[model samples]
Target: MKQFFLTLAGVFAGLVLFVIVTPIALIALAAAGSSAPATSPNTVLELDLREGLTDQPPTNPFAAFGGAELSVIEVVDALDRAGDDRNVKAVLIRLPEMGMTPAAADEVRQAVRRFRASGKPVIAHSQGFLPVGAVMSSYMVGASASELWMQNTSSFQATGFAADEVFLGDAFGRYGVTADFEQRYEYKNAVNTFTESDFTPAHREAMLSWMRSIYDSALANAAADRRQTPAAMRQAIESGPHSAEQAMALKLVDKIGQVEEAEAEAKRRAGRNAQLVSVADYVSNHGLQPGSGSDAIAIVNAEGAIVTGRDAGGGFGSGSTIYSDDTAAAIYEAIENRAVKAIVIRVSSPGGSPDASEQILAAVRAAKAAGKPVVVSMGTYAASGGYWISSEASAIVAQPSTLTGSIGVFGGKFVLTEALGRFGVDLRGLSVGGEYADAFSPTGRFEGQDRAAFAASIDRTYDQFIARVATGRRLPEARVREIARGRVWTGAQARELGLVDELGGLHEAIARAKALAEIPADRSVRLIRYPTQKSPFEALSEAFGVSAEGAQALVAVGGVLASPEAQGVIARARTEQLRARGASVLADQPVR
Candidate 1:
């Protein structure tokens, strides 16, 4: 019997060995076989602006998975490198379905113009032309293109800007649901969508004015770049959508052709035979090697809600949360690295955990203590915990329409006892521990001292938040509270409130950081991005199998649960839950 068992065990071990070693051996053979020059060697980097340029949580999965999105710095750096690279002859700018913010569009336009000045031509292509947003059909930026091509069958759709608001008041009324929220700012219209059928006059007026400013700037830039008058571009925009031939006649596009034809034209202009390469591929090939140099500004981005602790699944699964530990560690590494001279905190979050916020804030402080200037650039929405980290920065820059500042906190328990009772299930417990032991359980209402204790803790955290902001912004505690109370504000309003120092975009933030660091404007400053690091082996493993790193995250979370830090973890989790629930109540404007 023992001999039979040993034979079975030996067979199982052999199977396991084959399972592990077969793939690696195959990969090695494949790698060896493909060790040749790239087939499409001479490349024309294509920057296809299909989605909205955002620093916020990506609304679309394509942007995250397809890797088609670019941050402001990423776009600029690509342009700079492409312009200088002899192998990269020209650029194909495809704005087939762009939905970028005005500021981001402007940055790209500026970069395009700079690239063109290098004597490298840029060819713009679109499937169907559209002027739906300032970024989509900015005449000012379009003007910079050496040639604009639209599909032969395509037509331009130039609908003027409109901010549509969706209200749920009637829906809630039918369900007997009520929304109770407290906010300090008159412009905090987040709750309006829940309470009103349409925008209030104030909201409409504010939104329109902001839109107009952005559109006008875009039009002016496009006109200047395209060598057309603003009046002419405005006339074309007002003429509505046009067929390909009509667009060419109206000087809206240079020609009518397919994407391949446009690429060919670009190649011809570059005076070289080149293959078109995606921007990501080009960056992968030519961008700075990670951790290679000392004079670099690492951009550490935390684009979504900052939850506490670790998140399994790389924070990519649907409804999965952002892990503050991962983000903070990224920042910490950048700060500790002598290779990174400065840090850019690009935030697009609607806030999350107070504990996580403090964790990040401490890291930012540590970065400063290391003599690294940390500059913050706000994206679409950076409120609450987002603002918490930014308040510690040496300088903060935001676009005029950027939503920021929700200086408040709330916490509550979710009671499911009645629902369970209805289902004929009951939970009874006897505990010898403290009252707070069951503070977070979903089955019971937090009553008596438990409720009071939670509230007191929240208040203490709030006080700390205010104090931190006061120190960061150089404002008194009382004055900060005046604008606190979970109020949200637009970038312009934030600037007026002294919450942000300037009204600008990412480039401006970088410039400010460079100036603070005493680097000359003309001198080159290399940017270094943090976290987003992976070895070729790791990448291959991810492409083929479940990542060991993911397993490690689960183990780490389990360890946290088993340790003394469990209380802090639980508190942070509760804070994140509140923030997630309160997000809709704290937006300065309605999400589209």
Candidate 2:
């Protein structure tokens, strides 16, 4: 009674607060949408990346709670536009100490490269160059500028690249949990974390191969940019933990100075009195208006973990997810729309479900058959199922750091009867239907026949994945298989191996799509965002409905539980729930 009334009152208050907050946000976005870009004489486009970057900016309802983060596309397009603006005399990029993906860094570098082609100077200012713990990606982005200025007090730590994976088999065993799993091939070592104590031979080999390749690629590019030999570059990086003065002495950076000093240098180069323009503000003004042109290039964002059926959102902050039905429907919708001339599938996934990949690939083929040329634009990654869906595109464009490849399959369930028993919970399984009916039961392990069936399924899925790559890439099946053993490759290496046709970004993909469809280079095409953006109201409803129960539970347990660690425990339980329902996909890459 008292509790019921309290809960009811809480719900009502939440609803009212949500209703009140939503409209204010909508009105702000509306005002933002209507506002024109401010003009200034002798503009220097200021790109401060402290806001962070994403492959696709989350819709505002989710984003409003956080600080501003721009999409890679937005950043790149803005720079590209600034290249042609007469008023824009130079560019200033401020690299965040926190870091960004190598692929994103490469994209921004490409944009700067283009802007520099206009004979305008590009300068970079950073507090530090963080190359600690896979910060290689971040380092790659900062070094792209012609002149890099580091703060006098900052440090440079360029330790190069490595892949780290955690093994929980022994840890789980301590708790009496057993992972009953098998892989189709040796390369499919995703289950090793649960079934083995350390990396399998195949997993070790694959990780080493890709890590070395990335390291070498970075070394080569940095050498080329700095006019140093690869050998010298490697020596300099290995000799790191250098102070700003030491970094300058080592020729790693042009100078050690404050941000204001860097800005003064830009103004000096731009003939003085140059105004600074925020790239974000500029891009918003030049952003593509849907249905504005006679012909359209559909940009269908395929970010996050790809899953089957309709979009059932997951991931912390709803930051990542690619629903099979939603993606396929978006592709099909683009195909059906007479106005859309070409399609570009911008993929920034580490892979997901094999079935979901196939479904999305089917839609890509359907669009091609319907006469719309499809191009795949790879972001930070497009591996496993990410590569699966991309395999059938008319062409694939990827940044030099974009991680692709990894065609393999692995699946099974954890047998936790002993673990549960240790917790004073015992379970019994009864199945009268079929031999493999209890195969997925945590109370039991798979028998010989059930194990064989599961292996066969993985084998079949792997074969299908290989076949798609073979057909889409027009490579021999043998070659596809040769590369199919769950191998990851950077875009620079992938192109050499014939995995991607071009080493580029979203703009390159758009250009390729236009070329494939025979659209003239000078002709304008509407970049229509596909899968249709939802209204703020609809997005708010979705956000509230999806997480409302969890949010309420959080409130109810406020007294007993607190802090993010407590929240993390709850989140892990949610992940286990998702796993039990087979929600997470196989190609889901661990965050680098």
Candidate 3:
């Protein structure tokens, strides 16, 4: 009786604590809202494009906890607004500090160019230690800047472009894991990393040509912007990276200075001494008013794989993975929101389950049925099911290097008959009613009938995939099949093949989406993210050990509780497996 009373007391204590903390948390959040900066005297918005460009807005839980990490779209929107704000003196292009992808960097570059065009002087500065791509992109935008500065102590690390692939064939062999995979063409090197020691001749040739084309184009653009010959830039990169002093001597940088010195130069050019504001602060201050209030555009970011359920910290954060259900629901909600004028579906997935892909595609169709334009912006890898969901978009945009159009489905079970035999395990089972009763057992390989059924299912899925593509792209069915033979293509190739309508990045896709939605180019649009907000307490409970009791209970009930930590480990492992399978649609290399 005393022990029962103690248990009851513990439950009561927990309930009381929850009630007390909930109101305090809400009050604290309310107080946080009041701390927004009223105004700034001198604001030079700094745009950092470090983590390759993303089509979807990032969710930063840390930001909710008081750190500031701007979403990609948020940064772009702020820069656009800052160009017209009278209090905003100048803008700074800080790409070197943030290693951004060519596409993402291009978005910022375009924004900076627009800001400069608005008669606001833009200053571009870099700390010399930057990747070749970042340096080249920054140079392109800094060309339009009133001044370009590099840190005195910094030096360039402009190693000419190279793409590296790690092969695990030998390791797999050592582990007795056979990677029996099939592909339709030599250019399909998706499975090569796991099956071969190095790139096949065809793979090497294609990748080399693609890289050369991208690097050459980038160099040409940078040369034109910085007023340096491509040949000179090529020579400098081939020889060695240059110090900031050497770069200035070579006319690569306008001046040698630190961030503060660059800020002073920006102030002098703007002819105003004003307080400097970050891109995040500037946007918050401007509020969510539209540019002209005529019409609005909605940006719906679909980053990561399309999964079937919700999993926090598993979308785009560090150690993140895909949650298909969460993604599908988010897309569905975005489609139903009345305030969302048009939908821009930004995809960066490899592919995953057919069910999850269909779920997301259904939402896409619903969005289109509502007379809202849906435009797809493809990121680095949007092949397989990534291509599946994108087929319904009114317009599709891809970058030159975007890897897309892997139109195939593969499914099989790994039979561990030999491994189990080695364990001295003799398994016997009673006959089930159906012939396919043992279909999922690991003890045996799939027989002729099972294989035939599986093949038929795959064929049906492939046909549906082809039909979807044909209808969505407005292409003939035969033509779709011609391009859908499990082959991958660069964005440029896909555009020529009609898989993509245009060759551009996310910003261009957004522009096209707005045009399709009949929104004037000058009108304001705010991106509304789906997935209802979770309170800080809920977030914290999820982060710690507070909310995982159900998972623990499930594992224990299943008699799989080898240890206290086993439940979490198993949950993570299963989550990763789902992510790997689903993310295959957008990923270039398999998930590591």
Candidate 4:
């Protein structure tokens, strides 16, 4: 009987080994057999922005097993490559109904314009312009294309912008819930959603300022592209919710047709018998990483909230989170590598843990100390802890619509004992060692002393934040403090205030990094991606007998659980933004 048990154990161990080894070996063989992608003459490149946008590439390579949306940076890199390719005759883009932060819209638009500069005709189309749950960002990107086409069933959905908030104060009060929170300054209104029924004067003022700034810039840029004035753009926008025929009449859409019609037009422009090559297929064949081992500029993408420790992507309460330790390691790796000459830190975050922000900030400083020039390319929102890590960069670049700045701190916890009591639940709190042990306990409310202590802590952190910015940006302490009242600023305003170095997108940020690194303007340097992303074999290592087919099935499951559906739910949870433990130094804008 003991011998039989031992034999069973051996068989189990062997099966486990087979499960891990077989799939990896197969993936390795496939990768080894892969060849360079080839482009045929008169081929039209098809780029689809409809797959939705991601600030950066997949943190878990195996996470993209089913299919993937190319990160904004990846899209720009493809355009750069396709622009110079001799066989690529033109480009076709799909800008369907999608959600994009204004900054992302601008960056992709910039890439499309760059492609046009290469004398390649680029056409953009939409299945339904401004469909339900989409944004005007899609239309702005379409406008940047050489020509824009809309479907017959589509309509102009450039509904303009409005800032809104969901106040939970009254709702919580009805249930006897009380929030015990405080901020260092008036502009730090993050906790107000739970404490106030309506926006305070200060909160209303800040939202209007930034929203107006974003809307105006987007309006002006759209008009400029279409050869119209800002006033004309404003007038058209006010008359929005236009039908397909109205869009054509207003010159907002060039042609009204179906997907087939759009493709036929692109093929005609590319010459007879032109074939369409998908961006995904072309990238898969060619790869996105720098092929050469020579001088390179690493693109260190830092998206989502900043937290301490290394990152292991896609887990509960940690979707799209950026771990400072992982970011630091990537920076150090770039610095230590002799092949890398410069680094671009692409940051798109709303700030979370201050300690994590500091960790990333220290790493950026170290890179500069190691003779590696660093540039920060800000995306949709890089306020608070996001701004904290970016303050120390060699220079900062942002799109005109990027929301940045918010140098203040706010922290506390809600007391739900009363609310729970109404629901026939009783709770008690007991603490022995520390005087402030019950400070964060949800069973109790903040006592006067506890509130004061928490406020003081926030004040100290705010001061430290301001001092760091002043030192890094070479501005006076008073000047930094002037802008550090927990106020948000648009990228255009930040640039005007000297908070940002320039107003541009990732492409321009790369140009600035190249210039700072002393790389010649005409020289083409390979873009090195950081941290070396992983693959399917690594992700599904523990699964049994998983073939390529099995891998796809598993990937689909993982993607569904972790992709758009989960992200959308979190995005809509304005009042309860998820963060790591000890996120007291929270820096982020109020829900829009």
Best by lDDT: 4
List the candidates' TM-scores in order: 0.70, 0.85, 0.75, 0.84
- Per-residue CA lDDT of model 1 for 399-442, tens digit only, reads 76576887877655434555556567785666668878877776
Q: Point out where model 4 deviates above 4 Å.
A: 1-33, 65-68, 131-134, 289-293, 312-318, 541-592
* Stretches of model 2 off by over 4 angstroms after superposition: 2-7, 14-20, 23-27, 30-33, 59-61, 64-68, 267-275, 285-293, 312-318, 544-592
Model 3 TM: 0.75
For residue 447, model 1's alpha carbon misses the true position, in angstroms, by 11
Q: lDDT of each model, Cα atoms only?
A: 0.67, 0.78, 0.65, 0.78
Judged by TM-score relative to the true structure, which candidate is superior, 3 or 4? 4
Clashes of 1: 10
lDDT of 2 by residue, 1-592 (tens): 5544554465465434334444443454575558665557688889988677878756443453454557787888788877877888888888877546778877887788888898888899989867544455555556777798999999887767755689998899888888887665677677888878888788888778767766776677777777889898889888887898988898888988999999999887776578887887676566643435588899998888998988643221536689899899999999988988889999999889988989999999999999999999999899989999999999999988788987887788888889888888888888888888888989878888988898888888888988899999999999988877877888988998999999889888989999998999888888888666554444544555635545434334552334456545644654454455555534423211
The best candidate by TM-score is 2
TM-score of candidate 4 against the unseen true structure: 0.84
Question: Lowest summed-lDDT stretch of 10 residues in model 4?
Answer: 574-583
lDDT of 4 by residue, 393-464 (tens): 999999998989988898888888888898899988899987787789899877888877887888888988
Error in Å for residue 582 of model 4: 48
For every candidate structure, what is the RMSD over all alpha carbons to the true structure, in angstroms?
Answer: 13.4, 10.4, 11.5, 11.6
